[model samples]
Target: MVLTGWASMLAVFAVEFLSLLYLGTLQDEAVMGAVGFGSMTQFTITSVCIGVTVGGAALVSRALGAGNLLRARTLAGASLVLMAGAALGAAAVFLAAIAPFTAAIGLEPDVRAHLLSYVLITTPFAVVMGIGMMLSNLLRASGRGRQSMWVLLAGTATVAVLDPIVIFVLDAGMQGIAWAGGVGRLATVALGGWLVFGKHRLVDWPGRRALLADLAAIGKIALPAALTALATPAAVIFTVSTYATFGPSVMAGATVVDRVLQLAYSLYFVLPGAIGPILGQNLGAGQWDRVKQTVRLTSRWALLYGLGVATLLAVFAPRVADLFQVAGPGRDLIIFFCRYGSFAWALNSLFFVAIAVFNNLGYAAYSTMIGWLRATLGTLPFVWLGAHYGGAVGVLLGQTLGFALFSVIAIAVCSRVLRSPPTTDATARVA
Candidate 1:
């Protein structure tokens, strides 16, 4: 499950890095900042979609473990509808607010315009991509991790093939990247829909009442899960906005480091999704010991992976900075993160693993609380002080300190939860 999830996430990251690399070659800091702003904004909007999927996956996996195929199918179908609706709603809200939001951020005119264009072209496709994500998560919950991986790979492959043609050959710039992303999402929906609806028959349309009930149940988890997902992006958006004050060079460098972090630490990002089903199914089967064991093992693996990746990143930090053609303060930011800030990911991995446990084992509200605390108390003050003291380098160091502190808190809370008696009624616990 981990391997497949890693591959799927790798493909997604590869396409993103490719886009960033192409933009870097243009030697345009505004474009780089625009991409960073646009992508993070889109991610913020889509976090709700992810939360819904996480909620649905937890329910579906539990149902399947209990041998309740009919319930699983209904939940899957209803959840997809719910996810699409949420995506559409989020996109609408984003489009309406983005203009004013960008203005408020005080971005350079060119960067602001590019950011708007990127979101405008790509926002409408959120529904398509949300559906694709729903299907992929459903596939994983149904014990078809390989098919889920393929669903993601399909989108990645489409983007890989079209990005160069659209961006370079057609000279579409930011608009080209948006168009390719839209097309890639379409490809994902195509493959994912077939797998979930046609081949596996994993989802079945539910009646109105059933749909409402399932939605309500899913929302019990999704609401908190959504908040949990939103916390990081919200912190990141703030960080980016803060970084912008330092000048476009710093913002551009921060963007490069952001992409490198996502690519290198893709495992941590994918770990929650990969472990969700394991934890959910075990919980459903009343296998408390297995659930506990899975969390322990996952935590260990996350730490090991983090340490190894950090070492590699530090070793090759300079080459990576050059690869993005980032120079000046931006280059310094990248190198600084590679050498010092990268170690923070080791702790962040533990926090993420704890999140999976909370989401899957019916303690989702814990995830929300921890996530917000990290985003607010753990992030804002530290980042402000870091920037105030160390400039851009301080910012990275501060964020790292925040992660380390929060990871310890998360692990403590997670351990307490595990020691408590297990609950079979995930929804009831949430209520």
Candidate 2:
């Protein structure tokens, strides 16, 4: 499960990083910045849908954990219906808000055009992505993680192959990249749908009332989890907008840094993500000791993993800068960020693992509170201060300080939750 989940997450980072790397190779800073802005903004915009998926995953995991196959199947089907609806709504919102989104982010006209082009092309197909997200989470939660892995591999491979063809061979440029991504996600939706329907089969829709009950169950988890998921990206949008004030160079540079950091963080997320289903199942089964043990052991492993990744980032900072082909102020900022800002990710790993634990245990509201505090109180204030006084380095420092402080808080919260008696309600009826 760990290996498969890790590999899939890596592929996701690769798809984003390599696509941007191709843009960077074009020597068009505006294009790179546009891609970055579009990507980050996409994440922020789809956060609500992400919350729904997470909520569904939690319910599915708990249902599977408690051996309620019928409930699991019903929840999966309804959640898919909800996610598809949300995707269409999100698509419209993304299109309608494009002008305001770009202008608020301080993008230049050329960059804004590229960003608008990318979002306009890809936003509608976000339905495919929403379906894939829900299916992947459900697959993982249901113990068919390898199937989930292959689905991601297929999708990412499609994107990897198509991106260059569309951008370079077809001479489509940014729009081509967007279309390529949409095509890739379509493949994901196909394969993931097959896995869910053909291989596992969502139990069977019991009846309207039962299905609605399952959706209400999912909503309880999804709404808070979605709000929790929003905090980080919302903070990021604010910080990115703040960085944009320094001009496109800084924004572009920060984009490169963010991707690199995400690559590192993906590695960090492997265990936490793997742990989710395990904890969910165990919690559902009322295996409190196993849950507690898993948390402690994973927490230790996470700390070690964080430190190792940070060391590598510090050592390879220059090499990474060259690989990305970044130059001028952008290059310098990437290097500085790699050397200094990367270690904060070590702290971030702990926070993520803690979040996974909280979410899986039906403590999503607590998890949401933690995320909100970290993003708003822990991050924005510090980032605003740094941007005002110090520029890029200061901004990075401020973000790092936020991570450092919140890591402690997150750990404490997880510890408190772990110390409690395990819930006997494996179905998460209360949540």
Candidate 3:
């Protein structure tokens, strides 16, 4: 499971890093920033799908643990139905509102046009991602993590190969980048569908009543989880807006820093994902001690791994900065942010682990609160202060400090919650 989780994250890091690497080689920092905005536009919707992914995994794990395979299959089918419906709706809204949305965020005209093109090219197929999310989560929960990993890797590999051809050779520019990703996602949906529905036949269309019941079950868990997931993008929207105030170079630098962080902290982030099924099944089986042990051991591993990542980022800051071909203030800001924010990787790891535990244990609302705190209380004020006083560097400092503060608070809250008595089966059902 850990290997699969690691592979899944690695695929994303590879794709994004390659994209940024290619973009950087152009020596056009503004285009790089535009690319960043393109990514941010994509996240505006996919983050909402996190609820579906997390919910599907949690429910499926619990059902399987209780030997309710049939129920699990029904839930899987229902999730597909839900994802399709939601994806179509989201796509329509994004297509219609892209212009206004861009304006509301105060994007520069050139960047806004670039972002619009990217969103328009990719938004309609947003369901591909939601389907991929559902199928991958179901595969992981069913302990077919390796299979799921292969599906995503194949798709990401397709993107990696096509990215250069589409962007450089074909001269498609920013929009080409989105097309590359859409092709990759299309591949993921095809393969994932085969795995979930064709070869495995894991999903069976239950009657409408049964489907709706399962949808309700999924929604019960997914809504809060989705909100929790939504917090990051919402916060990113604010953070990016804050960075925009510093001008395009800073925005591009910050965008580069985000991609770097994703790469550096990929392993640490996977720890929480890898822990999800373990915690879910154990908690379902009433093995509280084992669940607690798993959290402890994996969290310790996350800390150690995070420290290693921090060390590498700090030590290799110059080399990493050079990879982006950024110069002037943009280059300096990227290096400074990487070194300064490296330690926050440890804090982020702790928070990820805690949130995973909370969601799997049916305290998703708690997870939501923690995420909100990290985004709002942890982020906004500090970012405001740092932007006001310290400029671009101060923004990084503020966000890092916010993570540091919330991580401790989240750890304490999760620890206390974990030690509390388990809920009764009836109470669990109501939740």
Q: In candidate 3, how many Å is residue 330 off?
A: 1.5
What is candidate 1's lDDT per residue for 1-431, written digit by digit as tens? 87898899988998899989988878998889888888887787778898998889988998999999999999998899899889999889889988998899788888887788788889999889889889999999998999999999999999998888877899888788888999999999999999888898999989999999999988988889999999998888888888888877888898898899999889989888889988888877878899889889889988998999999999998999999888899999999999988988678888998999888887898999999999999889999999999998888888889978998899999999989545546535532
For every model shown, what is its TM-score relative to the native structure? 0.97, 0.95, 0.95
lDDT of 2 at 179: 84
Model 1 lowest lDDT segment of ten = 422-431
Rank list by TM-score:
1, 3, 2
Tens digit of per-residue lDDT, candidate 2, span 60-139 = 77778888887788888888877877777777777798788767656678878777777877878787888888788778
On TM-score, the leading prediction is 1
Task: Find the 10 residues in a row with the least total lDDT in model 2.
Answer: 422-431
Residue 18 of candidate 1: its Cα lDDT? 92
Q: Note the Cα lDDT for every prediction shown.
A: 0.88, 0.79, 0.79
Pick by lDDT: 1 or 2, better one? 1
**How far out, in Å, is residue 69 in model 3?**
1.0
Off by over 4 Å in 2: 269-273, 423-431
| Candidate 3 overall lDDT versus native | 0.79
- Give the range of the ten consecutive residues with the poorest summed lDDT in model 3: 422-431
